[model samples]
Target: MKTDTVKQAESAQINVITEESKQVIYKSLLSALTIIAISILVNLSIRVDYVLLGSSLGETSVTETLQLIMLAVASWSFFLLSKQKPHFAHAAILISGFFAVLMIREMDYWMDMIHHGSWVFPALAVTALACAKAYQGGKGTVNEMATILQSPYMKLLIGSVILLVVFSRLYGMGSFWQHVMNEHYVRDVKNISEEGIELLCYSLIALSAVRTHRELKR
Candidate 1:
């Protein structure tokens, strides 16, 4: 009877822990979703303004939206990492979050280039990194190789190196690069491409959210 009682207590404790974890995860998920929604709305507003006014009324909207998105992704990623057992989904969220943060930080620089009509190369480079990271994370390649290659750390290093090279090349372009970098890159990219990139980023966030929701349900 005592043994049975002890087992029941242990089970109860585990249940409590499980419930606590679920609450934390759910809160994080909620936070991310809310932030992402706000960002999307902000971007949409900016695009509309650009189309109608032919002026950058909400020029800073994109930067603000990106910042919110980065925070949202980071919260979700941390929540995933705190799960019972870390999974590929967690890694995906983490990578996406980190990349988002980097992009957000460099938004000012990109905008400067856009204003000066020289933001193409850096913008393309950012797009490339986002696509590559999302693909790798979604496919589980990063998770699988993490054990052998030390995974996330290695991947981060590689990404940083790639960005360095790309940026260096852009800088080496001399006067043109200087002109582009000094101008606001955000205002320079065609409205269509700006909208497209925003959409793509949102899609990636949604994908991550879906995966996390599915995992939690299971």
Candidate 2:
């Protein structure tokens, strides 16, 4: 009887380990597929920008449209996170508001028609309201935000942000383009390169938002 019990326990533990290893492999495969799909979409958008959009990588291009869509998805995901996780509501609200501001900034050309640099007004309003809400949450707000910032999703988000705000801008510098292209320098080519990178950054932000939301659910 004692020998039977020992064998049963060992078999159960091995089964458990096998199940866990399967799950890890499944998740890894899924992530790999997701990355490949995103890369394909990014490449297709370039063709859409050039062929269908008259080679104009301007505000009206497919790339910019995709950027808006990705940001909107990210903002809505964070907003849902706020609703689902009440303890992290304030932090989520602040993050969603930040994405909202980015969306607004992307529409600055249309906003400019209203008034020069009119996008700043709404962006400032969102920032102030989000800050106030987070402040109202007090110390808990800081703790929640810190918890979020420590996650792998946050690392992805931060990396995407750096790509969008720092690396993309520097890489897209007109001076750099002029030096590289010399006599062949074309504004449309530069715009396409910069906008494509921005699209990828926004896509990553959307992916992180989705992953974070799913993680919280689990």
Candidate 3:
């Protein structure tokens, strides 16, 4: 009877730890966005260090570098996660592959520099198909995917991700927005909003990956 009680206590403790971890990643995500928004606002309003931070907040700037680094880290995280947890092998592999494509997309300028700009779309399509194949053929992939989709937290985050992508595309076409918004405001928002939101999203994903790795470790 004592041994059974001890086992029950251990299980409850594990459950508490898991719930705490879930809260950690989401809190980290909220903090990420708040910090990014504050930083952007400060950068835009400050005039003292304008010379130094002027272009640091723009294209090929700190945000871009951070994006590359975070996405690469996420890819590595998922690749390692797959090796560590075979039950999630297929889903992890697909996520890793998708992030790899994202990294390439983020470095589109470099591709153009090498005169390979035209290859991006086709390459992206191929990678998407490959990931789809992995999902369709790998055992247990459907169950894993269903689990993710069924999680309310994941559903909310995934929905935010989709919305963010749509917002990015619309903001990227700044000229179209000028007719509706003040030209300067449109330009400024277009310049900063996409990168700002993207950075927050990447930070969230990276933190989530770190959390997943820790959970799987135990």
Candidate 4:
């Protein structure tokens, strides 16, 4: 009778733990949605879509700068997540490194470095090292990482990010619309769409890292 009671107690504890995990995940997902929404709203307001607001979309402007900032945030968040959660360390490293590269590229340093003829081997070497590190630790595989990150909220976030890449600000370009719609004149709303989408995407990445970190703390 004592043995049966102990087993029942253990099973109940396991269930409680599982439910708590689920709640954490759900909260993280809500955070993701909030981040995306807030980013979009802020970007839209600043760009003023189609209205002349003297945005940086005219040159290699505010959009790139914003992207760089968000990438930095994402990278930092991933680094924190990696330290806090060993099981996700590999994925965190991979993502953090990628965002770092993206942030650098967005700043146009790659072009200047190449122009000076000094950007060849180092970039490739760094990339290779990062890839090796990501695949090194046996705590988790890429597939397992994907599985852990494949909740509905994450799926929505991923879908939006993919759309931002595939469709891009190209959809908002006047020439693109003119070419497709057979119109003579169309107005491109500066960099509103591009920057807005980028803000949303990077915010999602950052929020996901924050969520993981919080969950691990528990």
Candidate 5:
């Protein structure tokens, strides 16, 4: 009778632990979804603003918006996933977010606003330090990392970033639209470029999702 009672207690404890784990996973997933959604929204807003007003409003506006979104996403993802999947989700968010912040600084440089452009590098540095702690004995899943790295969409996204970096550097300190415009024709090439880049980023993210779904099916 005592053995049976002990078995029942063990089973109950297992059930309770399982339930708690599920709740934690569910919350983490929800938070990740929210952060991703907000990042998408911020990217959309930058695209829309560029479409309406061009870069004449200054790339700083778009840079600031993007930075805000990255900050929120990184903070939330780090908090929720660091304990669960430290190497995969936590490290990915931290690295990606810090990279996004660096991109913002690049934008500031492109706009010739060096004085007001001090935070991004420091933020990235701090994230780097935190990463050493967060990923200390954690190793990411090989299959998941392979799945992400093998996606064709990721290749295209990487190519696009390379192109944008080159283009932005070559045309420094002035709006692309301003350079393209003449007294007779006011062409807004900057808007078109910004919108195209935004679409490409979204498409890459969607493609990642599709790739994961396909992998699950197989």
Candidate 6:
């Protein structure tokens, strides 16, 4: 009877593991498809005339809207993590605040209406507030931050940041674009390349944030 019970328990454990694996696979596939679909839709919008492609990937374009949506998803996910998982609150505050700054940067075209480069002031203010919140959390904040940095999702998060801060900027350099387009250079083409990569990076970051939170919740 003991041997039979052991075998049955092992079989049940295997089944559970298999089911969990399938669920992870399904979610990964779905997330990838969603990102791909958004890319396609944004490019399609450029040809629609009504979607405002005159600025190409500018503030009014679908690409910018989608980038904001992706960043919003990431920011909201981190905010929700702070509320739902108190232990991670400090790190979440810092992360979500950073995303807020990115959102502010994206809206700089309008921000300029208030004052040229006004977005920098708000971004700096938010950074200060986030740091203050984390400081208030004391040693717990530092420990939680270490935990977050050690998370597997950190790799993806860092990769996305590198894509946004390094690869995209270098790839989108005006000199590179000018060299490529030569006499036929167009500003919209450069914007599309840079902004499209940014959108992809944002999607990755958002997906990483959601997956990390789910893992932490478990």
Off by over 4 Å in 1: 1-43, 51-59, 62-67, 74-78, 84-97, 103-192
Mark the 10 consecutive residues where model 1 has the least summed lDDT.
Answer: 148-157
| Candidate 4 displacement at residue 39 in angstroms | 4.6
Tens-digit lDDT track of model 3 for 1-218: 56988999988887675767889998889867865764564344332223556663543676677777877887788688778877666777777777778787888776777786854875678587648857675667877656434534444446546755786677667666676576455465565666667766665566556556555545
Native RMSD of candidate 3 (Å): 7.5
* Candidate 5: worst-modelled 10 consecutive residues by lDDT: 208-217
> Sort by lDDT, best first: what order?
2, 6, 3, 4, 1, 5
Count of clashing residue pairs in every prediction: 15, 0, 0, 0, 0, 0
Runs of candidate 5 with Cα error greater than 4 angstroms are: 1-55, 59-84, 87-90, 103-115, 130-153, 167-218
Instruction: Report the Cα RMSD per candidate.
Output: 14.1, 2.8, 7.5, 7.3, 12.2, 4.1
TM-score of 6: 0.80
lDDT of 6 by residue, 167-203 (tens): 9999999999999989999987787677778887887
lDDT of 1 by residue, 120-139 (tens): 45545655764565465565
- Worst 10-residue lDDT window for candidate 6 reads 45-54
The lDDT values for all models are 0.50, 0.89, 0.65, 0.62, 0.50, 0.83
Give the better candidate number (5 or 6) by TM-score. 6
Write one digit per residue (lDDT tens) for candidate 2, span 1-218: 56988999988887675767989999899988987888888878988889876758778877788999999999998889889889889999999999999999999999999999999999999999989989999999989888778777878988999899999999999999999999999988888788889888999999988998878756
Ranking by TM-score: 2, 6, 3, 4, 5, 1
TM-score comparison, 3 vs 4, better candidate = 3
Which model scores highest in TM-score? 2
Once fitted onto the true fold, the runs of candidate 3 whose alpha carbons sit more than 4 angstroms away are 1-51, 56-59, 118-122, 125-136, 147-157, 180-189
Q: Residue by residue across 182-210, what tens digits does model 5's lDDT show?
A: 55434345544554454334333333333
Question: What TM-score would every model get versus the actual structure?
Answer: 0.34, 0.90, 0.66, 0.62, 0.41, 0.80
